[model samples]
Target: MKKKSAVLLVLSVLVIGILSYIGAFGLNVGDYRVKSFSQMLSKGLDLQGGVSVVEEIQGKADNTAIEKTIDLINLRINKLGVSETAVSKEGNNKIRIDVPGKFDKDEVINLIGKTGKLTFKDPNGGIILTGDDVKDASASISQETQKPIINLELKPAGTKKFAAATQKFLGQKITIYMDDQKITDPTVDVAITNGQAIIEGSASLEEAKNRADIIKSGALPVKLKVVQSQIVGASLGADALPKSIFAAEIAIGLIFIFMLLVYRIPGLMANIALVLFIVLVLFIFVTIKATLTLSGIAGLILTIGMAVDANVLIFERFKEELKLGKPVRSAFEAGFHRAMSSIVDSNVTTIITGCVLYALGIGQVKGFALTLVIGVITSMFTAIIVSKHLISWAINIGLINKASHFGVNLRGDNNA
Candidate 1:
């Protein structure tokens, strides 16, 4: 049993050490890659720098209308090829948009908040069809003309209306407009009852695609006015990231030293568990694709302290049991068993607080709460399971048998 425990302890330490190194420095073997936490985790607007805008509905709108407006705005932003953009409804009548990375604020605002009402009109300025009548729009190169064009698919009603307009105005120009701005004017050639048509005046395929995406996103169900806008500079985020990482490194380093000094062997086990805790939390973040913000880093640092606190409690219990002349194995078991309640109580309360913050808060606060909750739960597992098993294995291997090894001095007693 002692031999088995020694081998297991060594293997566990090796695995944890390797994981910790890889988590910090990443690994690339052939095509398979494992990114470091800094590279794997997504950064929020506050961390990466970007534009954030909030818009308010101008008039009273129902739930369905507000939801539809949000969907349309998200579609518009996505079509703009903005990755990591967040579009969510805030309050009852407001929508918040977060676009990460550097971008022109005005262009983002216009693309996201605009009421893109597309219309087809005759040369006499009479409306022939609205965006609602159009079923789909796509940008492609014309097979015959070899020019950029926007292909339009119309609804049954729009097909009839467009057929009539084309027949009546054959050889005349029919204009298409988006938000009163003219897009294309094509002369009717052969008018038929087909539901398909093409607009062909784009100078480039990129412009054609932009126009098609705008038209395809459809109009917002309700008018919205921009209420707030903020821009974060990329330089600010760039500076903050290194400082935050440095601070975390210093904090964790101090924690590792303190644990090793105060509790000796048990402290060493706790330190190993702490490293595992950090790796597990980071793994969860990467798996869930959670965005890390500045506030989120604060939460992570705070939980590191909490994770140490659990080990402190368990080690103290172990020392108490040793002073009572309990065998090393019994004392180890008693330590974890007695500390379990306190650990669960503290961690559960913290998790509840994190839940409340996540439910009530927005933006950075939400990020903080999410990180805190994940850290707390992961810390609980490390302290209760990983740390317990590590110390148990060390004790079983006869590496830890005396009370002095746990910083406990039973001078008058033979327990040592």
Candidate 2:
């Protein structure tokens, strides 16, 4: 049993060390690559730098209208080719947009908040069809011309109207406009009843896609007026990230040293568990694609302290058991059992608080609450299960039998 425990302890340590290295530096094997936590974890607007805009609906609107407006705004933002953009309804009449990474504030405001009314007009400037009549629009390469073009599919009513317009104005130019700005004017060659039409002459595929996305998004259900806009610089986020990381490293380093000095062997075991705890929290963040903000980092640091607090409680009880002259094995069991209630009470209350904050908070507060909840739960697992098993294995191997090893001095009992 001792030999097996020793072997298992060594293997666990090796596995944890490898995982820690991979988490920090990542690994590349052949064609497959494992991204580091810094790469996998997403940075929020405050962390990555971007534009934030809030727009208010000019008139009264229902929930459905507001939802549709948000959806249309999302479609418009997607055309910007920005990743991790967030468009959400704030209050009853306001919508908030967050686009991560650098972008022009006025350009984003104009694109996302535009009504995007698309119309087809005759040479006499008469409206033939509106964007509401169009069902779908996609940008693709024309098979014959080998150039980028927009394929437009119109509704049944639009098809009939377009067929009549094309027949009446055969060989004449028909113009397409978006918000009164002319997009294209093509001469009608042969027009039939088909609902499909191709708008050719785009400079590039990207330009065609942007035009299609705008037309496909149609018009917003209600008019929106920009209320506020702000741009965050990349330099600010770049500076803040390194400083936050350095602070965390220093804090964790001090924690590791303090635990080792105060609790001896058990403190060493707790520190190992703490390492696993941090890795698990980071893995969860990456897996869930949670956005990391400065406030989120703060929550993570706070939970690290709480994780150590649990270990401190358990180790204190363990020392008391050893001083009572209990055997090492029995004391290990008694220590965890005695500390279980206090640990549960404190962690459960914290979990509840995190839940409440997540429910009521917005933006950075939500990010902080989410990290807090995940950290607290993971801390519980590492402190109770991981730390317990490490200490148990150490005792089983006869590696930690003396009370002195646990920083305890008993009058009559030298070994526990």
Could you say which candidate leads in TM-score? 2
* Per-residue lDDT of model 2, residues 67-177, tens digit only: 888878887787677757877777678889999995699889988767788899999999999998899999999899899998989999999999999899998988888
TM-score, candidate 1, is 0.77
The stretch of ten residues in a row with the least summed lDDT in candidate 1 is 407-416
TM-score of predicted structure 2: 0.78
Q: Which residue ranges in model 1 land beyond 4 Å of their true spot? A: 116-217, 412-416
Clashes counted in candidate 2 amount to 0
Candidate 2 residue spans exceeding 4 A from truth: 116-217, 412-416
Structure candidate 2, residue pairs in collision: none
